[model samples]
Target chain A: MNFNTDFTPLTVDPDKIYDYSFSIIEEEMGEHSFTDDQWKVVRRVIHASADFELGRSVMFTPDAIEAGIQSILAGRHVIADVQMIESGSGRKRFQKHGGDLHCYIADPDVAKEAKEQNTTRAIISMQKAVRENEGGIYAIGNAPTALLELIRLIKEGVAKPDLIIGMPVGFVSAAESKAELAKLEGIPFITNVGRKGGSTVTVAALNAISILADERAKK
Target chain B: MNFNTDFTPLTVDPDKIYDYSFSIIEEEMGEHSFTDDQWKVVRRVIHASADFELGRSVMFTPDAIEAGIQSILAGRHVIADVQMIESGSGRKRFQKHGGDLHCYIADPDVAKEAKEQNTTRAIISMQKAVRENEGGIYAIGNAPTALLELIRLIKEGVAKPDLIIGMPVGFVSAAESKAELAKLEGIPFITNVGRKGGSTVTVAALNAISILADERAKK
Candidate 1:
């Protein structure tokens, strides 16, 4: 059924926080496209997946999104617009950096457009972002379906991201999505503790990546 | 920041889904509230936190919500309600079961009354659902902040609920909210598997609980 019908702002219950989990998972699986030992200094992140199935609410903390973007910038990964399902408080955080921040949404007006065309639009956008910014970080948030399609495009030589970061912040699809990325033979994925991560952990993953990169750079 | 400014539907790039992680985490630190630990079951679930955040054009799935309620009916604890926040879909699901559901935007009219009353009407309604349905499962898909508060009220004798579930499906406040519920000493929590979970995993957790209960019954 159409999940999007009546919408409203959400009321938060702070005391209920204990019910969630804060688990992160990181893996170094074989690359999907890159060689086993190619060793590419990666910097680009994308947050392209389906929006939450529920109503709209401010889920991510600005600090978390900022941390993710900051890591890419510090690593000299030109920050591509965080490819999200839509824009909200999180987008504002990225826009503050004064860079090209593109918001990719499934335009209802273009619902008739072929899925391939929509994918191509997104791929072209990513390709442009990477081409314009050398050594830039292309980051995508935790949208597994979108990421997978993008990966297919990349493997097909339509788009190329230096590094792919998988940071989907929920319990249902996070693991499977990450696994999909892990299956990509060459790219290194930096992910969260999993399940109860939310925005804080998403940002934390970026922080971890930045720290790891710093350590590597020092050597 | 007023997070509820642009209330629109979010979209999904089917191709970009791979960019997200989909794994589950199983932590063994917490205490189980049920006497029949053998009856308990768990699974990880995930979903988009907001419809507008991703853009508009995605469909909703009631499988997660239905699964949670069914599990509780079958006797199991649910960790998350991945789609509770989608007012329209949530309400429709509730109605299908002969339940009454309502959605409020918290505009000036409702917000003023809500503030003056020192309570949210929605929480009250949800609490009523829990209290009225003894030995039955009731789930809330929004953030736990308000639900937790309602639970505290119930604990204080101001409200009552036989069972209450929290499953806000996003990376933003999901973990923090669930963590709050987990902290409650007596309440049993069945959460998602890290960032990978969504509505699918939340239902799985409930199924796990039911299976455990079934196993114990046989013994």
Candidate 2:
């Protein structure tokens, strides 16, 4: 699958914002370093974020791309670290595939647990997400604490995820968490190198994968 | 009201993420240009978003900071262009000051109107927001079209707002809309120079002003 063939803009804008963004990003990226599927995500990320830094920051384990797509194709769960990520994800794409998009940070129970535990609500949200869907695709966009908790749970043999898209933004643990994610052996993850990530970047990757799955299925 | 006076670390952690981020940004932003209150907003914007692009991009009319603080102090409404901005904004701060935050992008009524009018839902959301709260603080984070529409309404005297925080993040009209904002002579606003703004940046500004108001009131 070539980069251009794998995905198309879903909107009806005559200006083709996504289309022109793709072309410009490809020009700046210069070389074809990523696989076609992986490029699909990277292109959409720079397109969505308008930051060419992602071209250098985006790190993907070999199987991470395929894992996200397969999960999307199968209509698996996408559990986000925060409501912002869940809100920014590709809505119509998920609707078409019957995707289960969830973010528990706003749940009354999660808030209660966080207050009782003296921990961040994001940590409680991750614990609840892993408890509900062990093999689901996880997207962490807002909280480094959540990503760190997810890593700890996976190490303790507590839960497993099909894929992890870790793009938490903040100076506190944001860069360190991505470095930790890069070191993990078999989690199959997509992450960046530094503190330059947010829910928008996380959702861009998700929206890209969902778009890929949507177009691929049509064929 | 120096840069270092108005804000201290909010959390207990000794490793101050916001503090260090502020120092680095000050170094990057060489000369002190903004007013003390204005610098508070700019510092927090760079803190929340680790992009120095905002230093050059952030645009504020002379009285925008004091205007936003005054509106927040008075418990005016805050209408956002997207849910992500609405969700990421510090909620308790608003409640403490009796501020009302709203986003109608996903509302069924907005959806119905968008379908009926053949326009984007964000335009309809802005229309509804100005109709409901004539002196509200308008926060636009994810859509240039929404910002453009808001500017149009204000230009046409169809709507009025206390302040406009326009930071839509994309390539299309992001820069143009901000340029438009700078042209509005009397409309108090906080905007940026380019496409390097989003829900995070928009909420960061809102959060900064709210925090300033909250702390200033405590004194």
Candidate 3:
């Protein structure tokens, strides 16, 4: 451990680093089918993970970008599967449109319901969203159960989200859940094919949508 | 969109999923050199990211785990680089030990300081941490500038933290900062090589240390 200390970093400006990162992503990620709007979200995901494969794996429904942009512009709230997504999301962007991000996984009532029903808090959270939130964006990042439950609710005609960003990462049905999400029609969705998505990448996807909405609003 | 609706998930039980995920990780992540305590931390990282390559790249100083446990047991607060790490951390565990997790990146004062100095809020946040948070665990996961600044403060003898968990993610300066942290002597640090870490993985690492500390306290 030599404390010689003569290591200067590139640039300390946050914005510069962000711009430089996007430049690198554009240069490295060649030839994609995503439209400019969809690419915004994919670029941010790649920027967040530095994984071009995961970024390229991202799939957006025909109306995903449009649905997300309209919902965000309309001030529709966001339902995150975990606290990490709620915390990491660009809340100010949501708030600027009169919306907020909510996560009920740690709520006492959700916990009590999960314990009583022998279900995950994520499942209970989606159920709670059905009653408390409508026409909001559903962001499922950490729990396959939550994504599956939301899909069930959508099938049952009880949950009608403006958009679903389902990107749960893990074994034990993570890939299956995303596959289910991708197969669903009518409701717009943004998901990936593999078990590579998590709260961080999900947050990036949401932030990208928000940025696009913000840009559109500026026009 | 097939409204067929008959897709039940593998299990709705959260604990079962957690257990099953760990079993898979244990079986798959065979032949590691980490001690039991270190494996506890690394396992959680693998669980969070589901990336075996990233998890295997974790490096810990000789005294890293012990320093973390002692700091946590002594109820030393944690200073996170971003809100995601602070929000995602197991606050109850820290509170049980009489400590808290804090992130000053969003503070107005820190923003002002960054603007005045033409530096990132991450750098200013570290400067603030030096003044307001001594002997606390410094968990940096999003900004290489913050990690580099902390390393500078450590070398200058102005910052004395119990542990430094530096794992910022990105293409620019992320790997270089961790490399510099690895070279620092007499500091208990946990980091990884390459550009594959972020707030989620850093939170996982901190939570693992807190779990270890809690387990030891029960003994």
Candidate 4:
């Protein structure tokens, strides 16, 4: 059963992994109230993270999931705030239709300008991302400051995001930033309301949304 | 401030980032006792994560940091249990010689085999990693089962790693696995003592060690 990925031996099947993950999530979340689409997002997040608590924390604008699906189907870009978010996103499959997964935090120029501006590289990275790709998915999984900056950019009419996935984990500003993101209008968003989110969960959301898009297209 | 990377613009200088990181760490850790080298790994983890609590949680064997530095200098391979660790590792600099970073969790074969075995891809990935590299750095950041499997392989005489960097996050087995890793005689390691480790911190430690090796070579 060794699956091969780029010539390496894999011990898990992608579909089977997700299938079993949903099983676990369902078993653990007995007697809970969640819509089918909400389960689609939360179950995958649990699969990626094994953090069941996340199921309770996840929030989405009424149209956020559908917005993400539409954007993905349209081949809009997906810009992650950090490399892990981009890398774990099942990036190749999601972007198989010409969409791109981009992260500028590791870019040398971002680090340099961040220092000069005395601001977080994440803030600068968001600006670069907005400039490069408008009306794209903004996946912020590692930096609350990046999410804040994205919101700020939008407020300034400098950035347009079709859907925002904000789940940066930590203590300071992690929860606060998500709260701010949750309140943003005119921009659809999925957020975990507290400090319990991370890159893995963010990527899970991306993967689930991509899968949803594929499923919807087949129908 | 021109940090060179692919495509995305970066702004923070590497040196300045680390300097500011150390200052934040110092301010957060008002009265702690750590040697200079331990601070190197801890401060960088905090920099990468913005989690000051990590500075207190990071643990290192007396020689683990040095062991990792020497392994890189000698051009040994780095095998991360997860993609995030591999991606965050500043892998190119450490492998400026002929060393490489290997991760098989995303391997299709591993995924398939893991489903068949009712085990994690991480476990199978560890076995494959051991077969491919000896006396390399074993970097396990996202899965305790992988670290446990590595130890089992070592006990079974299947492999020998120069150093172990285990920082798997979660509630179950995260701290327990690190405790076991610390007990392995003659196998140097860097680990957090509790459930406070993650991929970012693990990679931060890896990057810090690489920087130390580069600094040492400069002299």
Off by over 4 Å in 3: A1-10, B1-10
Off by over 4 Å in 2: A1-15, A27-29, A90-99, A115-117, B1-31, B90-92
lDDT of 1 by residue, B104-149 (tens): 3233554565566655544444444344443344344444444455
lDDT (C-alpha) at residue B160 in model 1: 38
Candidate number with the higher DockQ (3 or 4): 3
* Candidates sorted on DockQ, descending: 3, 2, 4, 1
For each candidate, give its TM-score against the true structure: 0.38, 0.87, 0.94, 0.75
TM-score of 3: 0.94
Q: Pick the candidate with the highest TM-score.
A: 3
lDDT of model 4, residue B189? 86
**What tens-digit string does per-residue lDDT give for candidate 3 at B75-158?**
889999998998889567788898888899999999998899888999999989889976989999999999999999999999
| Native contact fraction (fnat) of model 3 | 0.76
How would the docking of model 1 be graded? incorrect
Estimate, for each residue in A1-219, the C-alpha lDDT of model 1 and write its tens digit. Answer: 221232112233322222111111101222333221111111111111112211011122223333444444453443322322222113343333443333333334223343546543433444444445543344555444445455666577655554554554443344445565556654444443333223222333343345444444456
- Candidate 1 vs candidate 2: the TM-score winner is 2
Question: Could you arrange the candidates by lDDT from highest to lowest?
Answer: 3, 2, 4, 1
For each candidate, the alpha-carbon lDDT, in order, equals 0.36, 0.79, 0.88, 0.78
Inter-residue clash pairs, candidate 3: A185-B1
A100-189 per-residue lDDT for model 4 (tens digits): 889999899998988888778888899899988869899988777799889989999999899999988754467778999988989999
Model 4 gets an lDDT of 0.78
Better of 2 and 3 by lDDT: 3
